[model samples]
Target: MAEPELIKYRSATGRWVLLATVLGTSLAFIDATVVNIALPEIGRGLSAEAAGLQWTVNGYALSLASLILLGGSLGDRFGRKRVFMIGIGWFAVASLLCGLAPNIELLIGARVLQGIGGALLTPGALAILEASFVRDDRARAIGAWSGLGGIGGALGPFLGGWLVEAGSWRYIFLINVPVAAFVLWVAAKHVPESRNPSAARRIDVAGVLTGAVGLGGLTYGFTAWPMRGPGDPVVLISLAVGVVGLVAFVLVERSSPQPMVPLRIFRTVAFAGANLVTLLVYAANGGVFFLVVINLQVVAGFTPLASGIAMLPVTVLMLLLSSRSGALGQRIGPRIPMTAGPLVCAVALVLMSMIGPDASYLTDVLPGVVIFGLGLSLLVAPLTSTALGSLDDAYAGIASGVNNAVARAAGLLSVAILPLAAGLGAGSLTVSDQLHPVYRHALLICAGLMAAGSVIAFFLIPNRLAAHAPADTFCDPCSPPLRPADTVRSAR
Candidate 1:
């Protein structure tokens, strides 16, 4: 098939493409944040313990992280538009299942399915923009995508809070059906088809299986450790299996002719350093996003709507400042912003830890959230650009997928392990007396993680992307790369 003509960013077709991709990707992004706000309501409704709540969040992250690399590869070989539409349809169906689920077991199962659909579409949305837009307009198009998508993320908590208060936690998931249906119609009608002509036909089934099993085992072991103790046979076995599976995954990637994750990309020091920073920073992020809302409601005596609204500032700051930060990184270097941002966030987390029973929102919550927002806005764009910019354009898809997978996996593990590390026992997430101290300890740990990330950035990240980096390489913290590299596309 002939390559479709790349359109100008301001044209009608460009606008439609942007709208479809934004809405589709937002479904996944919003779901990630929104569910955190609804967790308390879901717990009360289902009579679930802390373990069940953690699983509800980690289940989605696990599937998405494990299969995201494969998802990018599939879109490259199949038509991107086709895979994206399929993902929307799949995600919508999974959301329905989650809404109607009668038990915690069914809800967690449905969440895993939703992650599968997220894995399929998240990279495809960015890839479509890279493939569909003219070279001159690509950067502008991506910048707009990032800013617009950030709005969805910013609104997620508030929307989820309102839904939970207005009626049921079920509406948070159910609302996606109509929005997704509209996205599907727009995508099918206006989105053009594109693919990597040289993409590999072989799929790396072994890599995918091992990675999934590895993440699943580790997540289950950690989540169960607090309730069942480290000495429990089940926890021991799960931890053992997790270790073995991850080792096998690495070995498989090293030997496979067409690996799902080409281990060679890590050889680029900048790429490797950027991803390491991502792991540390996002691990802290995962803990904060997961626990802070719960703390506000359970410990601080805030309403659901109030807790959700508290987080709006972080997203708002990112939406407003991210583009300027990206430009600043390009002009000076990523190292300064990358290093300073996390340190700022570390300070913010320390402040957040001070909130307790009867804490005032104005004095206790607003200060930390505003500071955290400023730090995140500074960090995200540079980190994203450096990770992708370090590699050649051909590796864009794979690079984006790897970085995204690291972020998701970091969040998955943090949510599973933070409670145990903080000394919270079974079913203590909603208990104020037990939770207040645990929440304080957990935020301090997250602060340490962010501080460590800053250290990594200061020592490891370069002052600039490599000399050969693409001129049009622009940042999109919300999305990944535009296309797959030649090595990835032709692997056999």
Candidate 2:
């Protein structure tokens, strides 16, 4: 297979392409966190169980995590721009349906649809950016994308809280409609199409089905087990099916000629280590975001608006520093920052666990939030750069997709299992005193996970400059070196 000639997009063209990817991916990132702030409101409105509320979040994440690899492969085979536009359209429609849903079941179903759309656009956005820019510009472009995307995520809780307090939680989904429309228009008008010419064109339907079924069953089992007793037939059946399906997926992937997730990438120590760290760190991160907001609102007597703005420290830090961190990671390599960042976050989480039911935000919460935010600012950009940087450009889409899926899966499982693990099962979510202990336990557990991540990074994440002895030797020898100017298959 011949490498496709890369096109150097003009400065103006790069700006538009960046705009579209940032906005397109932001739709998914924002939606992921925004809904968390509204969960309390939605639960109240719908008279939903804790498990039902969990499902509303996990259902979307499950679908997105399961299908994202396939989505990336599709973009690599088909045109990335075309697939991205289709995803945006699909997401917009699903958002509309979510806003209109009157019951928890319908809303969860709609959210699942939304996740499918998100899976398509999310990886394609990163892949498109990677293909559009030359290696010299790629790091900077990704930095900007990461920083701006962090802002979108930071804004979600604030926006969702405002909506939930002033009007309805439905507006959270409705807001995406206009944003998606603008992204679709800009992308179609200005973005060029690109695909991996050497990638296999065949879709892995069996892989897709088994993966989805596996994720769906596991998410369902975990989420429902808290509400329905562990002994319930539904819980037992779902867990059994989920385990079987996941095992089957591994077998199928092993046998398939062109698997969606090529098992060979795991052979790269840096790649595998980065993803392993991703799983642990994000699991902790997800538990904090999902549980902290709800705990603040329900236990601490915070209003929706206050709860939403409480995490502003994280937003401020990321928006200000993530781009710089990305550049720093490029120069210094990812090992130091990745190792130190999670340890800082672990300390912050331990600090956060001290906030009791009658705690003050300034004395107890703000300090922890600030430290946690700083740790995150240090970690996220470098983590992303390292994971994708280690892979060949040809596998950029799938690589990004795999990492994204791991992060989502982490959040999905944490949201489902953490409350139960913390001993705040079924009827305890809304009670102030009951949730205080849960918050403490959950925060401590999260801290442990972050600490473990730090340990893993210390041992497994290689300092490529020191180890490989060449600045551009980050990728595998099988692929081309990461050069300043690399050709992409582009239809201008």
Candidate 3:
């Protein structure tokens, strides 16, 4: 059969549109990891206190994590393209504001605005891809998209660090301006919008508010912990309130007419398991990254560029192999790679734990990076494919959004949990002595998370690829909400 005409693009326009979406998405993805390198410069420039510095980053993360599902849900309510372009535009403006900020207070505020843009832009691209391609081509498309982000993640620190060291931290934010503007223009022209048929399933206002409040409150408390030394009553109070809010949000979502999270989605074992693995894996990634950057610069006395470059091998390998992993996983199944990736990554973390500050990069860091990179390359594509493949076009945005939000929240939770756990003075002893144990301990903790992820993926995820089903199979007469995305159709 001939391929559908709508799915095809003028080769040049198609490539360009793909490029712009990549740029739009990468801006959020890389910035989240890259900005950690600039924190010292930002802190010095703004006379930022410890808490202020934490907020500068965590504020954006929290907003992104909390509001993401709603952001995707909103795209479905309006139009994917409509919400996406608005998000990129907002992100650009926020970047400008972040660059122009007079103090840490204002900088943190602008960062939160930036997070709002990220929430909007990310899911629309994923939804558009699902609508744009057939099941066979969909994995390839998502793999390519994720590969671009993996590359950006690898390159970000080196580029961001160089700019910070040569000039000011302002340059890091400034660089995003042209990138965002270009994406906004291309997205406005090329992207098509899609949504669920039931328009009456209006955006969930109460669910959105509760989720945002819960995440925001939790992040605020965590941000305060380092400054308050974790034991302060005010910090404790914030933590208590945040936990209560999250529980309350969960209950609210279960009852809302158009639930932001739609607890029903978890009925598919694959969908549920993949999201769980996403959370744990991303958390490990976040925690390890935070510790590595600090160890490289603060402990080893590397320049900013040096710190950024340290991540190159891991990022490069992941970018190169991610698509292959998806292709292979499609041929066989995700069971081996998904479970193995985290398991291998866990072993790599264990190796990383052994590195002393004085440890040679070749002997200590490079080996760990290669192992971790290969494992992640295998995991990302398959997990992403399976997660979205389980759903229909209509629910794609929010489905992807929920997983993405969970990933971001995992990172935020790591940011909140790791530093305090690591005892941040990593400069205490000689470079090797001080950093060695810190790296070891942090990596070991990540290993534990990965081990858990491996088990969850093994048991919870079934042993087959997901496919879209037909109307006859839809909802089984009285099934609530929508059909489980992973249900198999009659093999017609």
Candidate 4:
């Protein structure tokens, strides 16, 4: 079959394609951090314990992280538009289920289903753009997509908080339904269908299953650890299973002809270093995004709306400075930005740790948030560029996929493990006295993680990326780049 002709970025079809992809991707991106703002309310409304709330967050991440690579491969094998629309429709249904869920268990289950849909669509959004746009115009289209999607991310917390305060926490999930429906309609009507003709026919079933089991087991074990001590047999078994499953996943990937994760890519020192930094940085990020809003509301005596808006400075800073930061990195090299950015974030985390009862937003929160935002604005682009640039062009898609999965998994594991490490006992997240100390401890731990990441970046990442690396790979600090242009060819 002859491939569809590429379109210009300025055309009406291009505009519609960009709009559909941006909105489609936003459904997943916004849902990620937005739910954190509504976590306290969700807990209260559903009578959920801390473990239940943690699962509510991690469940979505677990499925998304595990299946995202597979999702990309499926899109390439079948059709990008077909899989993307299916993901949109599936996500909408799951969101409806989430809104109507009668109990915490059902809500968590619905969230897991929601993540499956997210995994399906997230990669396809950028892949579609890469396939549909003319090569010369692809960068601008992706840049616009990144910037506009950042706006959705910036609005997420404020929107989620308002919805929770004005009505119910359920509205946060319910709202995706109409937006998704519109996206579906636009996609079906105007989006061109494309797939990788050379994509592998056989799916990596073993790799997918093992990876899912590994992440699921670890997330479950840690999430259950706070309520059930590590000494518990179930905890021990789950941990063991998680360890075993991850090892098995590695083995399977090593042997598979078309692995979801090409284990060989880790041979590049720069690629490996970049991902390590991603792991530590994103783990810290997960802790902050998960706990900060709850801390503001529960301990600092702010309303949901107030707490949600507190972090706006971070988003704004990233929006304004990310592209410039990417340019700076390109000129001076990524090493300095990557090294210094996390150090700045560590300092910000230390400041954030000081927020306590009666803390003023301006005096206590805003300063830390601003510093954190600046650090992220500096860090994300270079880190993403380095990750993609460290590898050959052929491995770009897999590298992006690997880095993204690492970030998501880091967040997932951090959400599960941070509370346990901080000595947060069962049912303590709501109590000011109980949560305050835990929050402080957790933020300090997160600070240490950021600091560690900086050290890794200093030692491991190179001053310059490969000569052939994409020149324009900037992305929103809130989410990693879905697929950078010139890096979108299927890794398979």
Candidate 5:
């Protein structure tokens, strides 16, 4: 009787726990995307050139991606609750540091520390949710929470813009402080501690070392190569060392009793292919958003607030479609939307390439937003469903961590590479002023990459959803399917 009562209490508390996780997780996503709208403000305020501003965002993502899996491992080995509290506490502190930092260099450093804190929080947050919620409810909760993160990500720029318009860009980071404080407090009261019961007693130090060094060096080199010159020894050395470290990590994972990244999981085609798709999709997204933000502000001369408002055309649609795509995939299949969405995005990119500075938002940006949002929304729900469903329950934490890391890694890589795709990193100007041409070309590349992803999804994803159709709880409680059916029956 006492145990049942305890279970009921935990379940009640678990709802709030997941809510806190949503806040915490969404904070990271918002900082990454929405903040891009305000980069010009930050750049001007700090007297930073383009590169410095880029680093402020990229550095956080880079650190977060590299360390996330390890963070998950740490949470598993230690207590997830303990790690989570520490992560939240540190994240709040780092946000304050970022808000207060006097110099560009200090701000970037603080952002990196904040990433470290996010890395610790993200996986542990999800793991706790999964542990608390049972299977069907778990899927729904995850979908809803993931959708919430998406909404937060989409809503981020608007929030940042409002803050920038009212206060300094510093307020963007400072704003996170209160949100973080609330989440931390709620999490403290509600979230329970859990650990990997089966984990090896000893830490896999070798694997951790290799993963950090390898991923870090490779990502840095990719970002630096365009500006540093291809022949630069620093670029070559970083790449070479990164390659070696990666190989070493692979070897270590194979031999270790416990591993940071389990090598065997990649052997599954669905798992591996899905993650590959995730990488490519996120990479394109990361790069594309940056291009859009820069083009709007620099080329079009839109204010931070204006740029964010202009973005509502895309994100609102994304929220609408994502909530429903899961059911649509279940009824028919994932393939139709999967193939069509990217193809549409490709079309949008092509249209964007043709638009000049004088192009109207309706004619240029609107069409692209509609297409891109539809395409991306199609991709998100199915990709998430497939990835999670592909694995056994035992690997949930690992799978989520790996998938999240891949997406972040892809975003970071895109940031590094797409800027160079312009082929004018240091050409006639310090940075190309009218990057419309470059933006056009880069967006076209994104379209092409997305087109390729569509093909991969078509070929790789299973034709049918699971026998137990999981509802995307993040969406409307009444799915579209049941609504139409109910209407038809009422006529009888």
Candidate 6:
């Protein structure tokens, strides 16, 4: 096969493509963090109970977590640029609706719509970047995307706090409109359209349906159970339906010629293991942040802005050191970093679990945040690189989509279940006395999740860096001599 044309790393087109994708996906990343910061404000404004706030957040995650694979599949089937632009437009409209929403019900509905659009665009952004740059430039481009993406996600709380303090939380949604418009313009003009020719033409409609129903049902059932009581018919039926839908989804995928998930990918132990680690680790990460910010505001008397700013330690560390972490992974292999990183994070969570009504930011919170940030900075790049490296390049989009779906699903379940397990419900989330004990328990649970992730990585992830590392490769072992085919492939 002939070589495809390369978009030089220094070219104007490459820069624009990177810019557009960075901005496009940044919208979703920002929303994920900012909404947590805004939750207390959202609760006050909407007169929403704990159950309502959970729905407000979970509604979006549920849709995104469930449909993201389908979204990636759609982009591969159609043109990535076209689908991405459409998603940006859809997101803009949804954000506008959210900013203008008059009631909690309407806001939740708009948030779901926003997630659908986000799912459509987020995977395509990375996919497009992967396809656009030459192999030599791909790693650097992805590094930039990953680093800047973290910055974007981190910016949410700072921005949301300012907006909320300035007298309205609606601006959080309103701000995305102009940003989305800019992304649309840059994408339509600069991004190249690409798709996999070998990709199946058949749409996985059933897969999408079953996945959504299953995830949404479980999230709803778990989140509502505490508020609705043990015998609530709606909760019981939802749980039952969720289980049935999940089973159906698996059966459907097994039989389908063009499965959205392509279960065969899990045949690689590394791929399966990485995703399991992602699920456990990200679940803990998500639940910890959710509980932390709320605790800071409700129990510790920190203002929304102060609580948001409290996380700057983690965000700043990630932005500064993530590239070095990536290089470290490439040097010594991912196993050490992946294993050690989660354990460090577990320690940080343990420290965080000690915070109480009298906790100080400098002594208690900052230490945990700094340690957590350091651990995360080490984990994310290596974790992602290893997961994607486990598969052939042909399946890059699908691999990323699957991993993303896992992360989001982990977050969705964590947010829903953690509070209930911590004994939080309805009107009790805001009461400092009731929430303090629950918060402590929740943090310990989160720490255990992270520790479990570390154990999984230690057991499952191979020490080699390359996707096709030989059977005998050990941690820190030298790269095996390449066969002729590999030589030619590497030259290309």
Residues 1-492, model 2: lDDT tens digits = 333444343365677788899999999988876798799989988899987888788788777866887778787777677788989999999999999999999999999999999999999898777665655456566777877887787777667878988999999999899999999888876665666656788888888888778877776776676667678899889889888888888989899998877778888888899999999999999899877888888877777767777888887888788877766776777888899999999999999887766668898789999999889888887788777767766676787888887887787678768887888766587788888899989999999999999999889887762221111111222223223343343322
CA displacement after TM-score superposition, residue 58 of candidate 3 (Å)? 3.1
Off by over 4 Å in 4: 1-19, 32-59, 76-82, 97-109, 126-150, 161-171, 185-198, 297-299, 392-397, 420-438, 467-492
Query: By TM-score, how accurate is candidate 6?
Result: 0.84
Q: Ten consecutive residues with minimal summed lDDT in candidate 5?
A: 1-10
lDDT of 6 by residue, 337-388 (tens): 8999999999998898888787799998999999999999888877876676
Clashing pairs in 5: 144-474
Clash pairs (backbone) in predicted model 2: 5-487, 6-487, 6-488
lDDT of 1 by residue, 1-492 (tens): 222345566677788889999999999999976897789999999898888988898788767766777676676666667788889999999999999998899999999999999988987787676666654355455656776788998777778878999999999999999999999888877676666555567778998889878766776676566567778999899889888988999999999987877888799988999999999999999999889999999999999768877888887787788767766776788899999999999999999999999999999899999999999888887887777667654455567667777887787678878887898866579899999999999999999999999999999899976654221222323232333221022111
What TM-score does prediction 2 earn? 0.84
Candidate with top TM-score is 3
Model 3 clash tally, residue pairs = 3
N/CA/C clash count, model 2 = 3
Q: How many Å off is the CA of 193 in candidate 1?
A: 5.0
Output the TM-score of candidate 5: 0.80
**Candidate 1 lowest-lDDT run of ten:** 483-492
Candidate 5 lDDT by residue in tens digits, 1-492: 111011111255646766788898888778866667678988888899888998997788768866787877776666566677778888989999999989899999999999899888888777665544443344445545666677787777778878889888989899888998998777766655555556675878999888878877777777677667656898889778878988998999999878876788787666777787787778878877777766776666666556655656566776666657655654566667666766777777776666555557777677877777777766676676566556543454566678787887677678767766766455421233547667777887887788888788778766654432211111112112222211111100
Model 2 Cα displacement at 36 (Å)?
A: 5.9
Instruction: List CA RMSD, all candidates.
Output: 6.1, 5.7, 6.4, 6.2, 7.5, 7.1
TM-score of each: 0.81, 0.84, 0.86, 0.79, 0.80, 0.84
Q: Candidate 4 lDDT, tens digit per residue, 36-101?
A: 878898888888998899889878877777677777667766667778899999999999999999
Q: Give a tens-digit lDDT track for model 3, residues 1-492.
A: 211222322244445556776788889887776778789988999899877888788788778877888777876666666677888888989999999999999999999999999989888777766654445555666777778777776778778878988999998998889988888777655554456655345667777787787777776676666556567897788778778878888899888877767777788788888999998999999888777766776666666667667777777876688768877777777777789889989988887776554557787678987898888888888888778767655677777788787787787678667755665552442355565566667778899999899999898776776666311111112112212232122322
Collision count for each candidate, in order: 4, 3, 3, 0, 1, 0
Off by over 4 Å in 3: 1-14, 33-53, 165-168, 199-201, 296-304, 419-435, 469-492
Candidate 2 off by > 4 Å: 1-10, 33-59, 97-110, 161-171, 297-301, 423-427, 465-492
